[model samples]
Target chain A: AQKVTQAQTEISVVEKEDVTLDCVYETRDTTYYLFWYKQPPSGELVFLIRRNSFDEQNEISGRYSWNFQKSTSSFNFTITASQVVDSAVYFCALSGEVVFGAGTILRVKS
Target chain B: DARVTQTPRHKVTEMGQEVTMRCQPILGHNTVFWYRQTMMQGLELLAYFRNRAPLDDSGMPKDRFSAEMPDATLATLKIQPSEPRDSAVYFCASGSGTDQGGYTFGSGTRLTVV
Candidate 1:
């Protein structure tokens, strides 16, 4: 069974400030996929990023970045200089025949 | 850009009524998945198909839910005698392969069983 946990249920930050969303996962499989998805007010799940177990290298896309740490079983997401558009419910997910996760709601205010 | 499409974006029905949701996967994709989302339960995989063949549906409630891929492009999920607890946003996603990059998701069908 693969389980993903996002400890922060909700987070608020002023625009231009940085914020980090924590995600911890447990999986016995040697190889698996980790993903971050954003659900805005429109209720669409937008794929933000995907990381496989073999790749430990951190990734940066515009103001959004992700840190995948195998030792700690954590894949955390960070927003640098976030804008109001960044406010959304972010979900951390593990992939397989079955996927599970808890969600984090992030709010950015101007 | 090709994307997955789902029909009847919003549905409201009384309990015990039969409900059906449909999905059209992007052209050339071989795998399709059905998922449910709610405030309490973040996301749950109900069923998935590979190459139009049912791969895994263990997550689905066997008594009331059924998923099928009748053709290459179409997938359907049906709930017989639906219950109030079945109300949630149902999502359809497709992928070309089992790998990480092939996945693409649709907006989702909001089912509210009253």
Candidate 2:
């Protein structure tokens, strides 16, 4: 069984502010995958990042970064200097059944 | 990049009407999935298939919802006697069986039941 939890239901921040969306997951399988997806107003889900259990390395892409910590069973996403265009519903998911979190609606006001 | 394709981007139908949604998975992908998204329930897996065989459909309502993969590329989800509660964005996704990476999702079909 796998479950994902996103504590933040919605978040609002001014433009150029850094925001972090928290994600926690529970899975019994030693080999599993974690993912983050962004659904914009256009109604399309955009893949953000995928991290496997073996790789605990934190990844940074442009203004976006992900922290995967097996110790805490947490995978967090951070957006540095977020812009208005970054507003969207972000979901955290666990693989091998692909259980998704409730998602956090982010609003980046300019 | 190859992507999954879903037909009937938007559909509005009267209550009790039968609604059918279609999907075309990326070529060479062996796994396909169907999901429904709504404000109350973020994303729920309705059904999934692997090698054109139904893997799991326990998430779907067995009475009125039916899913099938008639061929390698095509997948269909039908809801008979659709109700207002069934209105949601249905998404189709595909993944390479060998890849551990996440699946690629389509634009989704937004269905509205009046």
Candidate 3:
């Protein structure tokens, strides 16, 4: 069975504060993919990043960055300077059956 | 950018009433996925189609829920007798193939069974 766990159910941070969301996954397949998605109040899911198992390179996009460590089986997402606009629910997913985490509700207060 | 489109952005139905949600996947995309989101379950995959053929629907409730892709452009999820527990946001996503890392999701249908 494939499973993704987002331990943090909710996190609140003030504006300009940095926050990191932790994601851990379990899968038997040697080759699989991991993904992150953001769902704002609008109820639409926005794709953030996708990382394959073979490529363990960390990725950074502006104020957002991801650290993928196969050794720990963890893919963490960090927001450098969180803003009110960044408040949303973030989901971590694993491929194969596309199992999704319980999602972390982030509240960035200005 | 082409995107998935879903109809009836919101629906309110009485318990035991039948409800149908529709989805139009992105053009040229061969894969369509249906997902349900609730506070308790978060996001759950109800079913999916590949090349307009049903691939996996094991996640769906066989007695009440049915998903089908009548054609390439359209996909439908029907609940014969929706219950209050079935209230959730139904999302439709589309991708090119199995290897497609990310899928384009629709705005989703907010279904409320009262």
Count the clashes in each prediction.
0, 0, 0
Docking level for model 2: medium
Encode model 1's per-residue lDDT on A1-110: one tens digit a residue: 67888889999999999999999999999998888888899998888888989999999999989999999999999999999999999988887753756788899999
Candidate 1 error regions (>4 Å): none
* CA shift of A21, model 3, Å: 0.5
lDDT of each: 0.90, 0.94, 0.94
Can you write out model 1's per-residue Cα lDDT over B29-52, one digit (the tens) per residue? Answer: 998999999888778899999899
Q: How many backbone clashes does candidate 2 have?
A: 0
lDDT of 3 by residue, B1-114 (tens): 888999989999999999999999998899899999988888999998899998899999999999999999999999989999999999999987867769889999999999
Rank the models by DockQ, top first: 3, 2, 1
Order of all candidates by TM-score, from best down to worst?
2, 3, 1
Per-residue CA lDDT of model 2 for B31-66, tens digit only, reads: 999999998888999999989999899999999999
lDDT of 3 at A42: 84
Worst 10 residues of 2 chain B by lDDT: B94-103
Model 2: per-residue Cα lDDT at residue B79: 98
Candidate closer to the true structure by TM-score (higher is better), 1 or 2: 2
Runs in model 2 deviating more than 4 A are none
Question: After best superposition, candidate 3 residue B82: deviation in angstroms?
Answer: 1.8
**Model 3, residue B71: displacement in angstroms?**
0.9
